[model samples]
Target: MSEANTALSDERIKNTSRLRTALIRPELGGICGTIIVFALFLIFAGDSGMFNSQGVMNWSIVSAQFMIIAVGACMLMIAGEFDLSVGSMIGFAGMMIAIFTVTLEWPVWQAILVTFALCIAIGALSGYIVVRTGLPSFIVTLAFLFILRGFTIYLPQLIERRTIIGGIDDAAEGDWLAGLFGGKIFGGLFQWLGDNGIIATFERGTRAGDPVVDGIPMLIVWAIGLVIVGHFILVRTRFGNWIFAAGGDAQAARYTGVPVNRVKILMFMFTAFCATVFATCQVMEFGSAGADRGLLKEFEAIIAVVIGGALLTGGYGSVIGAALGALIFGVVQQGLFFAGVESSLFRVFLGLILLFAVILNTYIRRLITGER
Candidate 1:
């Protein structure tokens, strides 16, 4: 073959191989387990309305939100680092927005802007401490978590000016924000779901074309937008190449001119910003915020990331896949309610998923490294 033809053939081969990796089913264990989840929910719980179109509609966006955070966590994990304080940070962000608005009587716009700044700063600060001190991110974030948790406890008393901040006099003010984040999609037939739709939405009670939604949950949109950005960064940009290189082999990447430290710091900061985005959504939706808002969400994000197939040691996984992992988690949680199983059983299932995902991640890492 001529030179051009040979080059074209080589490119085709590489594209085909990568596509196979991206599109193939995950390990037999995970694919089978996921299949079982779908089957069991369908078989045993179908009668309970979980199988209906409206029920499935109810779960999709929330699942998408979880997937978003899982994408960020997956990025961090791929870079061979971790942070455990995101949950508390979300609570902090929610409380911060509420305190600025409900307590200080700040305008909604001002409060939102300030809260956004705080979250980004906090995330960067955490990243800085982790990098500068050489302490493990796990330990550092744990310390941060405790500190933030304590602050959340104090927030209500301060905001309420009496050990509680309630009687907001309006959830409407924040509705715009909520709808932007956690709004509903089609309820019944239009959605290609199982049945007709009717839900006495907690927010509007009854409204045609409204989806009768609640909350200014911009977090959901924020998460999706971030995922798109992340996808671009991961797959379509030079930064993505460095990310893979840094995570896959930091020392080598550095020797080859990657700015290793800067990328790590950026990753850490980005994760923190995600926590903030979620927190903002919660405050808009709940119309109230407390220090306890994000008590365990960070841990859940980590679990979602791992389950999505990101390797703990770095240099493996996809943003979309990790997001899917989060969906799996949210589905199971919602599924439990439909199944009427105890809440504790859901946690048990989460643990099992984590265990299996970790084992598989390790195996995938082995496969990739052997080739390297």
Candidate 2:
């Protein structure tokens, strides 16, 4: 072939290969699933106010909750570890905040700070044990799951004679740090929209001409912020490469000068930090902390990470993919309620989707490894 023709042919071949690779990407499933879920919800729940501003906020908040925990779980999984203690950490952290602020009458900001420090320390301890003993992270964190849950229940009962702590709202009144987790943003913009008839407002009450959604909740903001930061750390920096290397092959990574132990331990601490963030938000929103709060949330976060296309083996994933998976969860959960379907079926959906995701991941892993 002539030089010009050969060059053109090569370009065409490259474009074709690129398309094929994109089609098989780990995020492909999450992207497709998100589209289908949204389409389905729009069709079935379109007229039910589920697409309205208020409805959008509902699902968005739920999705953000999932996104927050999933970010931490995603990074940890990418580093080849699991932290089953995440749910317990949430309850424990919230309880600690409540105990410090309410029972002990500490300032809300001080309580929040102390709770975060303690939770992160516990997470570091969990990581240290796993690294020193060479035990599976699953087992170590599972033990912590029970240990922390026990403390969550026992401490509240011992201190307040109950497993539920309240009065947080009163204590947090005018508290600056509490506002960061509990406050809303963009109030003026939402107010403008409401005045312009762009969004629904309270017709007649003590509060009239006010938007149903005053502003975006801080929970969603935290979720977006975490995703952005996590994505940057995972893809744009040297540490990001180290995470993949450590997960992909710890011994090889160590020989190559990757700080595998430190990376894994930091990931564990990060997971705990995320859990505390969730707990703080929840406590501020609800004005209470219960021992049973965050039950099974660890599994939900794992499912979100898995559905986002992170392999069970580790070293391959996308933060954006995980966020999409969380969005899918948030939509389907509220969509079912809006469509008037039984809410219990959400668990069934979780089971099915998890199975499908695992099968799909296995196929993708085999494809990458050329395994039979």
Candidate 1 per-residue lDDT over residues 1-372, each given as its tens digit: 488776655544434476446433333333445577778888878898876545675566567667656767877877767878788887777777777777787776677778878777776788788778978788988888888777877867764754334433264355454455444333343422212244333334454444433322345556677878887898898888888887888899989999877888888778877777776666655667765677778778888777767777787767766776776787788889898999889889999889978877776665555553
lDDT of 2 by residue, 1-372 (tens): 578776655544434466557746778879989999999988989999999999999999999999999999999999998999999999999999999988999999999999999999999999999988999999999999999999999999999999999999998989999999999999999999999999999999978889998999999999999999999999999999998887888999999899999999999999999999999999999999999999998999999999999987888887888888899998999999999999999999989999999898888777667589
Best candidate, lDDT: 2
Clashing pairs in 2: none
TM-score, prediction 2 = 0.95
User: For model 1, what is the C-alpha lDDT against the true structure?
Assistant: 0.70
Pairs of colliding residues, candidate 1: 152-291, 177-216, 178-215, 178-216, 178-217, 181-217, 181-218
- Which stretch of 10 consecutive residues in model 1 shows the poorest summed lDDT? 191-200
Error of 2 at 77 (Å): 0.3
RMSD of 2: 3.0
